[model samples]
Target: MPSNVRHLTSAHGDASFEACVVPYLDAAYNLARWLAHDDADAQDVVQESMLRAFRYFHSFHGGDARVWLLAIVRNTFYSLRAKTASDAAHETIDEETHVLVDEQPSPEARALISVDIEALQTALENLPHPLREAIVLRELEECSYKEIAAITGQKIGTVMSRLARARERLKTELSHCSTEACRHDVR
Candidate 1:
């Protein structure tokens, strides 16, 4: 058991990490993207977090690797955030996740997806750091409350409260957008 973390699964080394952590790259990137609020910065953070995880892989006892990796991601994001507080705080989130049009959906379908994505992105952007993380982990990453608690180093109660608050905020935000949109003229 490491001094700082709870019991992680005791296992081999790099190969074990490769097996356990590699699968969660998307989840890590998603968390990083939400935290850094920029795809390129998120990629940088994930890259750094992966390196740190590899360096500290020995300390990782063999529990849930996803939780461990995301914790490192959160920590890395905070470290970078601290270093570039002014730049990071004011950085605009660039939406670059390409929507798959391979299915050849109708133009109307694409437009609806665009609008929903825009409003959701705007709402998520407006969320404070804590609430944003909770929602992103729970809603986007599909992490259990226990897992979220572990990754965030927060009690389950705190995680649940933040999720509830975040959900309310998102609901209000989306509703306002929908109503204001009035079947068209969406932002």
Candidate 2:
């Protein structure tokens, strides 16, 4: 056990805030990063959310801790955004310029892969905030529709509709990019 792990007496509950909440840090950060669109802003959101989660940990009953933490994260991000609405409008989300690569490819190997990471990212960023979140929660975060609904405070049907629209929009955008690329190749 790490020295930092806090153990509530078995009487209170076996679930440590560290055990349940820490496991979702990456997922929390990922969602925050996408929502906040800036690394520093995302870090702030996660930090505040963690604090809020710790404060309310005793209230959490046995259930999906990830979704619980994410709901806090999402709410924190929105609150932060609301406070900085004027400034946020002027600042571009870093996701537009940075690609999150899960795997490192050698320069030679990278040349062989023709995927336009920037285009995909731009398309994702262009989506309405709600639709963008739905896609990220479903596709990138791999949350089920029900979990997404809970985290987002949307009906399951709304989650499904947002996802459907998001996918269609992405497909249309990417297809348009492909068509433009082919036209350039022909010329």
Candidate 3:
């Protein structure tokens, strides 16, 4: 690479990194947080993944940047987990941490008309990492089976199966939540 060519390439790489990787920060963090099961670890994983992605930005071809970034995030999380085996065993309890206690509604008051996003998020947080990641990639990120396969390094068939199972789990969980709420109403 010539001096000017190298400089131009550096600039282009920087621009591409910003345009492609920056937008996927939330998606990356969500995936990492689910997999790592700790806010700080998740943050660290995403930051490290961003740095690694930038360092190898030249390798990226034009495609879905979210999938590419997610793959990096997934790899980074697993690598760190493997390197720190015992450390990975300590799982943090996030249920009470993220739960919001709304002011109790009076019996005569109109029933709460809307489902809380935070509650739904907390429910998602409680899902196992594999199921959670599948749901996040397929439902939240709207990634196709092929893209998810690339990101997860799984075959398309496995991706499809995981996604189907994840959806079923979520539906079952949500249904239980709804039934509980209805039971509470009857009391």
Candidate 4:
């Protein structure tokens, strides 16, 4: 095992924390990145959350560590955002600038990757924060409703409701894209 895991296991005397919490680093980072919308902010959130979790490891009562850590991450992110509220309004990207431009694949390798996936990801990036976050957590992260609830600090029912609404909106958006593509083909 790694040194950090060894230290965590020995220092806290909690094997479960090392096993469960350490494994969730990628998921935690992904959530933070999606919420914060900046690589540095995401790293800061995850680091702070890990430190807090390590300090409070003993208080954890055998619940799912992913959900527990995610709760901490969510809280830390919102707190940081609140502290930086003055700068928030200034950093917003213009919507028109986010429109996807069809970039041709380089001459060297056109057959390896699908253009549709790139287009889909660009569309996903264009979604509003709430819908995008919901889709990332529920669909891409494969988080359960309970886990998503803990991460978002919402009730499980609310997470479920939001996920349902998000899926419907994504479906509508994708269908519209498909229709536009078909019309362009005919023309």
Candidate 5:
């Protein structure tokens, strides 16, 4: 093997990078899923992001691995968008790809849940990328404003403004849901 070849373990026999990244795979997938809006595309985004993170592991000083990896996920998604607009434009989330907590709800109950999920996802999808990112980071991932700003390379004020606008847009778009979950979520 060439000296420059990267492996799962570091040169000094440390697996710190891998260790740091493994726990956040689901978080990475969730972000990618939200941004790409399609299962296959989200998988691609996460794979590329993981590769990039490994390739750049040496450059990472000590910090929150989740934040660092998520930033990479965001960049990978945007790069894909820039390179192939049409590939992304037509893609939508495939219901079969996601794991449901319910083992097998009744057909009618499943339909209702699907409708609720779709409404929420569509509202999020309708948001502009910046606003969507803000909302996802803050609301879903529960990141603080400072952390979002750090990951996004934006001023804290910009992050706050985006979150505010995203929330309002989601509230208006989700007005029809009126369900307890939606009500509890959009505030």
Candidate 6:
């Protein structure tokens, strides 16, 4: 290729990635964090995915940028997962780790609604990876079933089935939480 052609191609790729892929960075990070289950790992996944996306930018035709980036993120997370199984097995836990502190506490304690975010997070974390991903993509990320199917490389029907199963499991788990909360309330 000629030098100017090469330069223009590189510029096009850079502009495409910045315009199409960069906007989804936060959403991509959120997906990565949920999939990887660690902030550092999630960050690594997002970075690697973005690099891969940029390298392959020519392959991307105009479409939903968020879904395309998320697809890349999902694949990267799985690749990382496969490579880190042994490391994950021997990982140590700290008591203070993973504690979510609300930075700006809501001043409205008028009704004291019991949502049990910790329980929900635990339930989501315990779900099988496919189910968890389906839920995260569909519910949390507000992706359509078709979008999720493309991102996850699954058939739309399969995505629907997984989401249904995930919701059922979440309901079962959240019911247990509610029961405990009810008992505590009555006491």
Each candidate's lDDT (Cα)? 0.82, 0.80, 0.75, 0.71, 0.79, 0.79
Q: Write the per-residue lDDT of candidate 5 for residues 1-187, one digit (tens) a residue.
A: 1113234335545578768875687888888888887776777888888778887988999899999989998999999888885754534657666426585799879877877787887789889889998899898998899889988899999999999999999998777566655667645
lDDT of 1 at 142: 90
- What are the runs in model 2 whose C-alpha is more than 4 Å off? 1-15, 87-115
Q: In candidate 4, what are the lDDT values of residues 8-127, reduced to their tens digit?
A: 556866676778798888888887777776666777888778778888888989878888887888788778788875635223333343344446866434432443454565566666
Q: Model 4 lDDT vs. the true structure?
A: 0.71
Model 2 vs truth, CA RMSD? 4.7
Question: RMSD of each candidate?
Answer: 6.3, 4.7, 7.0, 6.2, 6.3, 6.6
Instruction: Give model 1's TM-score versus the native structure.
Output: 0.84
Model 5 poorest ten-residue lDDT run = 1-10
User: Which residue pairs show collisions in model 2?
Assistant: none
What's the true lDDT of residue 106 in model 1? 85
Better of 2 and 3 by TM-score: 2
- lDDT for residue 148 in candidate 4, whole number 0-100: 84
Candidate 5: list runs displaced more than 4 Å.
1-14, 85-87, 98-100, 103-111, 177-187
The estimated TM-scores of all candidates read: 0.84, 0.82, 0.72, 0.71, 0.79, 0.80
After the best TM-score superposition of candidate 1, give how far the Cα of residue 101 lies from its true spot, in angstroms. Answer: 3.2
Total colliding residue pairs, candidate 3: 0
Candidate 5, backbone clash total: 0
Candidate 2 local distance difference test against the native? 0.80
Q: Rank the candidates by TM-score, best first.
A: 1, 2, 6, 5, 3, 4
Candidate 1 lDDT over 23-113, as tens digits, reads 7878888998888877778888888887788779889998999999999999999898888748545356464674535457688888888
